[model samples]
Target: MDATELQAISDTLMRIVTPDMTPKQLIKAARKEHPNASKRDIARAAFFSIIANADQDHGKAKNLQAFAIAERTQNGAE
Candidate 1:
C-alpha cells in the first residue's frame, strides 16, 4: 500500500491500540474497520505509526515498533 493508506491504517491503529495488546490482537482490531487489511498492511501501519506519532506516546510507539519488527523476522513464528 501507499503512504496515504498506511497513514490511514496507522491512525486507525492508534485509536484502537491498547497497552497490553499483542500484534495479533492489534491486527484483528484493525481488520474490524478495514476488512481487507492484510497482516503486512497492519505491520506496515505499525511502522508508520511509530514514526508519525513518535513524540506522542512513547509506550505506544515502542509497542508498534516491536510489532513491526516481529512481522519482518522469522523468529520461528507459527
Candidate 2:
C-alpha cells in the first residue's frame, strides 16, 4: 500500500484500538473505514504507528507490533 493508505489505516487503528482489544477486533475495526486493506497493509500501518506512538504508549505499540507479526505468520500466510 501507498503512504496515504498506510496513514489512513494507522489513523483508524489509533482511533479504534484499546487495551482490551484483540487482534481480530483491531483488524475488523480498521477495515470498517478501510475495507480494501489487507492483513499485510494493516500490519505495515501497525509497524508505522509504533515508531510514532512508542514513547506515549509502549505497551500499546508492542501489542500492535505483535498483532502485525501474528497476521503475517498465522496459518502459513506466506
Candidate 3:
C-alpha cells in the first residue's frame, strides 16, 4: 500500500479501537476492512502503535505491555 492508503487504514483502525479495546478486538476490527491483511500485518500495526505511544511518553511501552499482559490474563488469552 502507498502512504495515503496506509494512513487511511491507520485512521480507520484508530476509530475502531478505544482505550477499553483489547489487542484482539483491534485486530478483529481491522480484519473487517482488511480481510486479507495477514496476522503479521496486524501485529506490525499494533507494534507501530506501541512505538508511537512509547515515543510520545516515557514508560508508555512498559505500561502498555503490562496492560496487555493483564488483558490477556483477564481474557484467558495465550
Highest-lDDT candidate: 1
**Descending-lDDT candidate ranking:** 1, 2, 3
Sum up the clashes in candidate 3: 0
Where is model 2 poorest over a 10-residue stretch in terms of lDDT? Answer: 69-78
User: Where in model 1 is the C-alpha error above 4 Å?
Assistant: 75-78
Enumerate residue pairs that collide in model 3: none
**What stretches of model 2 exceed 4 Å from their correct place?**
75-78
Q: How well does candidate 1 score on lDDT at residue 1?
A: 84
Backbone clashes in model 2, listed as residue pairs: none
The whole-model lDDT of each prediction reads 0.86, 0.84, 0.56
Task: List, residue by residue over 1-78, the lDDT tens digit for candidate 1.
Answer: 888888889999888887888878988899999899888888889888998998999888888888889887844475
- For model 3 the TM-score comes to 0.50
Best by TM-score: 1
lDDT by residue (1-78, candidate 3, tens digit) is 555544455555545555666667766787899887654455545445455556654454444444445544655654
> Ten consecutive residues with minimal summed lDDT in candidate 3?
58-67
lDDT score at residue 33, model 3, on the 0-100 scale: 91
Question: Over the full model, what C-alpha lDDT does candidate 3 score relative to the true structure?
Answer: 0.56
